[model samples]
Target: MTNLTQARLFRHENLPFLLAALLLALLAGCAGGPAPAPQATPSAEEAQQTEALEKMVRQGRHLDAALAYSRLANRAAPPLREMYSLRAAELLKDGNYIPQSFQLLSEIQGANLGPEFHIRRVLLTADIALARQRPDEALAVLDSITSQLADDERDFRRRYHQLRAQAFEQLGQPLESAREHVLLEPLLDDPAAVQANQFAIVDELQQLTPQVLDGLAADEFGGWLALAAIGKGVDDSLPADELIARWRAQYPQHPASEATIARLLAARPQALRTPRRIALILPLGPRNRYAKAAEAVRNGFFAAYYARPRQAMADAVPGDGGAPHLEDAGSNAPPLQLRIYEEGRGAEAFDAVYQQAVADGADLVVGPLGKDAVSRLASRESLPVPVLALNYGEMNGAPPRNLFQLGLSPEQEAREVAQRAWLDGHRRTAVITPSTPWGDRVAKAFNERWLALGGHVVEVQHYDPKKNDYSLPIRRLLNVDESQARRKSVRRIIGEKIEFIPRRRQDIDAIFMVAFSRQARVIRPQLRFHHAPKVPVYTTSHAFSGTVDPQMDRDMDGVMFADMPWTLAPDALGQRLKGDIARAWPGAARRYTRLHALGVDAYRVIGQLNELRRDRAAHFAGETGELSLDADNRLQRRLLWARFQRGVPQLDTTEN
Candidate 1:
């Protein structure tokens, strides 16, 4: 059958009343009465009044137009009273003047009107009450209409039940909402309402018991899964395995069956055989500046691996302190460090590392710390064991399947800042960035995320880092249009009538400045002088990377920025790693805590690759806070926001 025919058949079985109403309306319109004779001329006064009302309605001045129409209609013949009442009803749909509209309708004795008119009045009053948030009043209006409503009003009744359910839900009466759901049960089978009912059932399950969900039919499993996934504070204590088994047995062919099975299977532990050896590569030479840093990171990684309980590694590593074979990427030799296992760049490095690991019977490969080394190793086509890139790397066109990059980046910080601003309800923002490549990178990421959230970028102003004056760019960004008189007064007060007016602070709601310490110090005070201190300010990670002097702190009060969470908490793992690093080199903990934490997490995940890949969310909450692998295989971290308070970066809140 054709789609329209199939739709008609479905509706006949699902919403018969709706179909009947449409048919009735169509038939009534088709059977027309004799046309009235054309009038000689239209009333000039009436036409003028209608034109004015039309203008008011077009301008969204509903109240003014309603009053104007009522006055004109009242002064005309008795037949015009219906026209005035209709116009008044249209205006009253705004809900602001519901009570007033009801009073007007009552004064006109609407109960004595025709059946259609009475029905319209009742619906209008109920809608007004609902808009005014008076659920009880709306219910009373609908109740009064039910006794007198004709048989043709079944479709209206269905709508009334739906509206009643919403009102009861809003009023926190779940029982009443459930009762309305029962009333809508027939409509639930309608394809148009199926998805909507699914959503509603999921919402209801938040307050319902497992017994209630179990009692539902097999067809309702999809709705239950959707509910379980999205419902707030849903109790997950019920065993997922058991639930999946029951669902599979009851509805083997359900649409969501495969996905549900996958989720259940992932929750189970996978059997993995222990391998003989593991390969560890690090840059270990005298000439490299990061040679000390690299050693510290390697120590952190070992500390994390050994920190796991003895039973956890019984299968993976043989003894209590099973040592992995270490390789050195050499001294003052870029190619040696960049090339993994004496191989050239690209897949050769990956192949060499994999072959060496396999030759030693290793289960995993860790590191090749530098970005170049990582890029070269990751360019390989295949590997015998999973390689965890210890340091950050450019993923190039695509990231390696078996390799994972774990490190902090500027793009991550910018995205976090923009997301935080959006969640805080700042819909309009301006970006002030340095005219540098790094500055552009931060600005681009921030702009992309902000725009993705349906926010508007009012201005993107770039300032030359080498230049001193930023007032013009700031003013242009703020779109400051100073009043002529105020400008003249300010100019006279300063004893110089300058042509350029400085930007005012109140113009933009939020400002994102992408600059380091020195530029931040200059721009922040300028923002305050322009009366923009009240506006919330965001900056990149670079803001906290530099020295914060007394003057800088004074200027940057209340400014917030995103950085790795280790900066604040530096968890148990982080502290242990820091202590290990400190034992090797004093005062190193304070400077390299972030990189140390990164190294520890990278090591832990490499050992538990199966679990990490199986449950991505569980891999999150490490020393560096939440971390997830996006579609691109790049690790996305949940950064924390810190405010500059008393010359220190303090944890603001757990908002982002």
Candidate 2:
């Protein structure tokens, strides 16, 4: 139904409750002894104070504003006092002072308060319960207040339904949550907010499986379910736009706006042109610096290619323009024809090979493994064919059109570390990384993300990775050297020996270290010796060797890092691939596990790049990580996190 009709129905249905709420407000006003005060409400002095407190809130001083509100409540009378107290409790809750907010809300009693105050108090109680992770309690409180809401209370009704939806989401009831959002869509006034609610509805409904969608009851949210089911047809032979058109024909009166429909069609994952002739380009010449790494990637690409279903290959179509096709009795060749092009040691050679591959009918190109090679390709505005570069290139802003980058990026891992540390309640941190270009990039990524999250980098020290002893950098990073200098100054002034222990800086709650396992083994022990044994350490995947060796890795205890599932906890497909690689090429399987996984993902991503690029929620479960594409056409990997405990990297179940 249309939003206007829905809103009118809502108001009509709650007519009795509205009249009762009005009576209660009138009675409360009479009992409190002044209708003049209700008209005047906040006096001039209270207005000034409230304006000042609002200024503090605007400046992010939530605690200060809350305290000011509490003090104002103490000096105010009757309903004003309770209103001020409710505002204070809301500010406290927004500032993450959950227990204080809860206690303040509990103390508030709505005896002779107006309808607004009564609704605020009830909503505040439910909000605090939600903040405390007590979704069941929050839902119960909301249920008790649901029927008491009046027709005129549009804002309160919005908040009430929003809280109910959140509580349902917390309880793993996405269908129920979606229904609540569908109900709330008509109440939203802002265009952006309405679009967000629409997307949220689709996201919740998308969580349900096809079986659930098929068996869904034709109730109030049937149009919503139907829309979500159409969106989920990414792999369907029928185009997604056509499916959406069919849905629009069926549910024209549904609440989903025109903008939302446009967005759905834009991001719809229709069947992209499948490249029958695929070109794999890499710096694989013997003299190339990245020859061995390229070899590992090549092996991985072929492994994934060969793993495709035999029947699918047997039923292959011809290439572009109905070119002739070839098949052997037992060759087990991929349906898509594959060719490897050797990207020689120079950029000039790479260009020549890339052109040759295109001339040879290469519809899709996946390679140019070197950064410089990828950068050369990225400089172009467009390419004759799509190129999935193995390494990210330097781009001033967004990536070039038709070019995608996917690699084991340390910068991505560093950013993940920043987010993980913030989630773990760390606000201040120190970083110790290698004094090299790669370390600088990783450190810059961490600092940018950390600062964006309102975290502070107390100190950032660079260490020489070649040096086995990291005492100097560690001491500098912890400010232990400064502490020792102070102790020496005290001893010299007293003209006698002084018993003192050098104290490390107390401001930092976490340490972000960028190092390989060898460097980390030394760094972790030195950090303990320097009196930082309890401080948490976070790092990139470089800190783990990807192979388990308890005796060697015992020194890595308590260090948390993010790595691909293939290295940490391989799934059945990954295990099978790992075994196949090990038997075929043991060295690449053992020594270059991560690169091998990257290669496998590169092949898998080739087919899904269109979907990943258009749809933000689309993902491919590959050997590398849960692969998705960012706006820049760069493939982003959400790696699994693990903590080293007694030399074994345990998958953090908290994340699961």
Candidate 3:
């Protein structure tokens, strides 16, 4: 009846005792009249139906049992009929017959069932409503039954709060959703699970004002808030040190208070599941769409494998110049036997290649770099080996545990830019991007993330890639054209000129630009010319080419962006690698230089994948970015922040 009693009754050691108690309850309800007088026998039809009901229940035919129970309810006394209807409703609910379950419960709505059954019926009814995407109806039902649940009936009490939480989420009421989790905390038994749930709630509350979180931390959800303060992946609105101090002052007795702070400085989890043999699948044809990219990646992977840590090769300058390069490995780190296979012949051939890779003793498969190849692999029943798919596959249900999707997606970069902007105190922003599919995708991703974070997109301007002068879009983005129109109209009305300064909209504090190095050079100065100087401009890695011509790029002196460490890490490790790339591939294209960095990370990641998967604090600072695995199991890279100063991209060491 009570939470403790229910827990004790259902515990493994008490399961037999529980079954005996259930037997007595069932017997007390069904055992016939007083023993002094002989009881009257039921009709033969009733006897046959009762036997059939027992048989259906025993055979695990729940739907059939529900049907038989419904028939029996028709002939039973009022109290018996209520019991029969409740039994049928439970069976239908368990069997996922939502319509039937709700119908049966509705039939018994007037049967005068007590608080326990009433609460269960209400919960089920609301659950069915939510399953049908009717959150408003669910909320109404949940509201009507509020007084029925008590601490004694913790089963339904727990479930009631869960339904309310989900309903509020569907209804887009975040505080209410968090309130349910707060209500749920005391009902849970395991501390880890409770902390995990609270962290999840914190994730949903990322955009909430600090005042709201502080109030909650001091009140009903103190422990939950404290745990959330230490939770992984949270976007902290307050400084971490200040937030932890506030939480401690609010709740001094909470464990993990100081210990949680220590984890932030600890190293990432070690690789516990590294594969000995790896399969490298690339489209090797000269004409393949990603052939060159794949080659660069492959070369980069091997260079990383051999570029032993602490070796001078990591810092050596390329013979050609100080360009990005992958130095050859000489040190004796036992190499992962890489088995290469040809792909890109056709999409249908991917499965065969994958199967062959497994047969060739590959414990880990790196990729089928083509998008179509990854899609085909995803559609399969399962992957035989742990796969680090080069490109993202179509998401259909939970992907195989072995499947990991990694890509240099423009969309990923855009989303990160939005998050960084929000963390940096930018609320009203404008977007300046090129007029192409890639540009459209990045802009859309930024807008989506920004809007979801409660920020506004003031304007989005698309410009032609070939255009050198972006004055028109600049004028529109800054509201200068409108300012000019107003000035002209005022001049005409007064028949004389008055002192006028073009006013850009005051709402925007940040501008997100998605452009290549050339376009960035042209647009950065144009943005300053249109009275938007001093407003922070954000861009992707596109803002900086691997090579820098300070004279040519001085116009982009203040733009910040996320870029790989291969080009911008500034330390000796980066310089050495850059020298390697320049000497190894003397004529390497500037843009493709990062691919070599990608290859380096790809090889480095195999050893660290287990670390990322298991430890929330763990991340791999590869050539691509700061890499971590997300809830969706996708490998996400949060790029290093850099600002161009005098044609060189320096790390933005300022706090976000």
Who wins the lDDT comparison? 2
Across 414-514, the per-residue lDDT of candidate 1 in tens digits comes to 87788667545577899999998988988999999888655788889999988767877776776554544567787889998588645464546789999
Ordered by TM-score, highest first, the candidates read 2, 3, 1
lDDT per residue as tens, model 3, 1-656? 00011111123222221112112323343358643322234458867876877786666556556655765665565455566667777776654444445555665644355666667677878887775567888999999878866667777777888789889887887788887877876676665545444654664575467887687664545565454545442546866677667766767765444543444313111123557677778776667777778777776766665565533222221211112333335453444455667765777877788788788787888877877777776666676687887777676677766677787877888887886676565779999999999899899999997886568999989999898999999899999999999999999999998999998888899999999988999999999998988999998887788776788888888887887667666345556655666677766636578887777777778777765765443456666776777644578776677778898777664331
Q: lDDT of all predictions, in order shown?
A: 0.58, 0.75, 0.68
The total of clashing pairs for model 2 equals 0
Clashes of each: 2, 0, 5
Q: Best candidate, TM-score-wise?
A: 2
Q: Give the TM-score of candidate 3.
A: 0.56
For candidate 1, what is the lDDT? 0.58
Candidate 1 C-alpha error for residue 407, in Å: 1.8
Positional deviation of 327 in candidate 2, in angstroms?
Answer: 19
Model 3: how far is 363 from its true place, Å?
1.8
Give per-residue lDDT, candidate 3, residue 235: 41
Show model 1 residue runs off by greater than 4 Å.
Answer: 1-276, 283-296, 306-354, 370-381, 391-401, 463-501, 505-507, 546-552, 654-656
Q: What is the lDDT of residue 574 in candidate 1?
A: 61
TM-score on alpha carbons, each prediction: 0.50, 0.63, 0.56
